[model samples]
Target: MKKVAIQGGGGSNHEIAAKAYFETDNIATVECNSFEELFSTLKEDHSIYGIIAIENTLVGSILQNYTLLKDSGMVIIGEYKLRIKHQLLALPGERLEDIREVHSHPMALAQCSDFFKQYPHIKMISRDDTALSGKWIRDNQLKGMAAIAPALAAEKYNLDIIAKDIETNKRNFTRFLIISHKEKIALEDILTQQPINKSSLVFALPHAEGSLSKVLSILAFYNINLSKIQSLPVVGSEWEYLFYIDLVFEDYKRYQQSLNAIRPLTRNLKSLGEYHVGKRSFDTVSNDNKPLSEQKTF
Candidate 1:
């Protein structure tokens, strides 16, 4: 009976990731029309958890959400990397030839751009949510319109899959972060509950040259591996930047030591969260040769 808040409606990839991370089919969703609402919902109801897409392999980091996460004071408890397979779905009884317009999230439309090239007559329309497009088409019994979304959306919205894996790159993936109220959940408690090998951190460096390099050297000396690093310009300060990084480590104590070692070198060092690096479940191979999107349970 776990209730989680997602940025999109039911059958959205956020909900899909939540189910995978929580490992439950019974989790209820508090759907928010937008990401801003998603965080606000959690603030109003501390008991409700939240899942949000942080980054995608095809697209870059969601920079705005980083600011939201930091400002909202939510703690990242877990993460999930979902393989994004875009499917073209239409209302039942409609064929691909009958569809003239395809609707989806902008990113999804971009991913399936190559697939639509064959049908230049079909126009691509961007929407706020991929699954919402499907739900809209279904609930309204719309015709001649299709949605580019996950297969789950097709199933959930009772849409016929006109096409499967339409994304230009079969390797597309989106990394989602699971968050909760900081006061409601303790970092130590989450660390004990899960095998935390990965951590996200944000910090500001001194203006001096090699200041960032010094911090990197210290982490390398501690046997920490930098998986991802992103730099966002500081708004008020011209030419100043804040660094957000993802680190993976084998030894928890060594990782802790690395953080302590870098604190002196960083101006505002903050450990965003420490959680297990999400496994790519959609990359699994089945003996029957079925697609990973079809084989995945959730």
Candidate 2:
């Protein structure tokens, strides 16, 4: 049984993503309070894997996480995109009207801000983790308090979901990266188990005219699709930036050739990882706002 590090409680989205991406039921979780702890855990124990949420459709990129990945010596072995569905959960026998305060992570609160517009009397509070808030409410036997978290969190803490799908966007999704020590991500196994279709790269170019455009042209010539590109300012280098790009290609050989052709054109270019792209899939969790008893997994 493999032990994975997640940046939250047992029922967090990171745990959910780690389970789904690895497709294992026996794996155990080592919960970390922060991303820095997650990376350090992996550094100390090369055998342990990690899952970290990198971006969300509604919140955009987590810039700090991007910087962490660049500095950390972890390798991206795979990815998972989980549909984010926020449920308002409270103690059993408690209805929505009985709830006077709702607690959740700041991002969760922001995502479900529109839903609370109708309930002006209810106070909104931000906490460290969504699942932790639910656990706190349940363990403390707090009345008139609800938590905005995932259904899994409610189930874990034995709370009743009073409201379902409270997020402002129904199509909200978060992308998580499955990472591990470089040695643990064997290139041979990835090639055998999954076809490599996508890769992430970080590089900086000379401050010359058309430098970025020329790199884009080379990628296009090799039929590589640029799914995402983000630039972060380099430390101590005024105005210069490092470009991080996600490339998807149909042919692995072509992707290699493209890299070879463009290596000289780049400076300090780093191949983050090569793996199969992940798809966004909605889980069967009563999207129609049904009760917990009537809910089923999709």
Candidate 3:
């Protein structure tokens, strides 16, 4: 049996992906309430792998998860994308007009702000997970209270989907990364056989004129492509910043050459390791599709 640890609050999205990816009957799923709990769960259960949400199309990058990845010892072995469909669920027979209060995760609530605006009289309450809110509503049997979650959640908890596709954006997607205590030897071997498509690094440059520009120019000198760059505030140092960069190159040799060239331009440089961008296969599913009644819950 393969034991996998997953972020539990948001919904069964992470758990569903894990089950689908592994496709094994001998799988044990462990739920973590928060990022902290997820990491700790990974540490305590060395046999389990961690599946985490890294970025969302509507809400932008999950910055905190990036930081956690940078600081933690976990390795990013794989990734999968899941389309999010937010549903407004309430007790059976409850109408939209009967709902006076809505609850869901902060991100879910924010994503569906436009939907909630129609009912200005209703109070919006933020909870940890969309499914959790649905379960709470079901348990309490609150007639005027509803939850913004997945249609599967409403079905699992015996709630009614009063509204569907409530997210502000129609094309909502979330990228999830699979982390494991045991690094994937097969992935590394495959990456080494070919060229590394993406490389990630973290560095701190001296606060000086053109320091940042010089670092960027070094990559351009080697003709490396910069895919993404984000800056995070340095802890304990007021106003100081650390830049995290993702670069794509034609081959590993060129990537190494670029790294060697840029090393001298920055004060502190750390290679957060490199891995080929895995195939994004989940994007084929249409985001507009609603969950079927037989949807499985974690």
Candidate 4:
């Protein structure tokens, strides 16, 4: 069985995304209590793969994960963008009206904030994992407790769905990165799955005016589209920053040329990955429905 490491329990979004990306149910989930533990597990077991939530539409980015991914030295084999739909789950016998306290991850709670406003009686408590909260309620047989988690958690933990699709916005989604040890996954193996058209990179440029602009100009000149770009500070380097970017392109040769052209302008240029961009998924609609992620170029 394929072993996938994720940051949470069986029914969490991380596991859900892994299943969708791998397109297989015949796998074992290695759940970790924290992201640190997840990376540590991968470090110890190179054969194990990891799925992580990098950014969410409702909020912004999970900044710490960028640092983790950068320092882990893991290869991004693939990516999956999951539409987040948080369900309210409770014990089998408990009704929504009977619930006095609702627990979930802080991010989930924030997404469903509008739903909670209608029921002032229920107090929102932030926990480490949404799926774990449901398990706790089920195992303890808590009557007055409910958990804001995915629908899969209800089935996995024997909880009933007290509510469904409680998120305030329908566009809420989280982008997950599938990563593995550099040696375990060959580039040819990933190529067989799909043609690569996207690349994620991180580089530090000289702290001078127009230095960053020059790199971007080179990419545009080569027909490369910028998908996402993020900047973080370089430790111990005063006022200096590290640039992390995701570039997408249709022409492979031009993409290669763009990288070579920018090498002279960038220092410590490293590729996070070069892989196929994932299809946009909005509430499981797939390709039939128009999704937002496909509409943007930069």
Please name the candidate that would achieve the greatest lDDT relative to the true structure: 4
Local accuracy by lDDT, each model:
0.85, 0.85, 0.75, 0.88
Cα shift from native, residue 259, model 4 (Å): 1.7
Q: How many residue pairs clash in each candidate?
A: 0, 1, 0, 0
Cα error, residue 234 of model 4, in Å, equals 4.8
Each prediction's RMSD over C-alphas, in Å, is 4.5, 5.7, 6.4, 2.3
Error in Å for residue 95 of model 2: 1.7
Comparison by TM-score, 2 against 3, better one: 2
Residue range 1-298, candidate 4, lDDT tens digits: 8899999898999988999888887779999999999989999998899999999876777888888888986878888988988999999878888999999999899889999999998899999999999999989999999999999899999999988899889877899999988877774375666778888898898889999899999898899998888888878995588988998888888898999999989988988878888754656534437654463786
Candidate 3 lDDT at 260 equals 90
Off by over 4 Å in 4: 233-236, 283-288, 291-295
Model 1 alpha-carbon drift over 4 Å, by segment:
235-239, 284-298
Which window of ten consecutive residues has the lowest lDDT sum in model 3?
289-298
Model 2 TM: 0.89
Whole-structure CA lDDT of model 4: 0.88
Candidate 2 per-residue C-alpha lDDT over 1-298 given as tens digits, one digit per residue, 9 for 90 to 100: 8899998887788877788788876789999988999999999998898888888988888888877888999888788888898999899889999999999899999999999999999999989888888989999999999999889888889999999899998767798988888877763365468778888899998878998889999999988888888777777884387898988877999999999988999888888778878754564543644321221211
Q: What is the TM-score of each candidate against the true structure?
A: 0.91, 0.89, 0.80, 0.92
Question: What does the lDDT come to for candidate 2?
Answer: 0.85
Backbone clash pairs for candidate 2 read 284-298
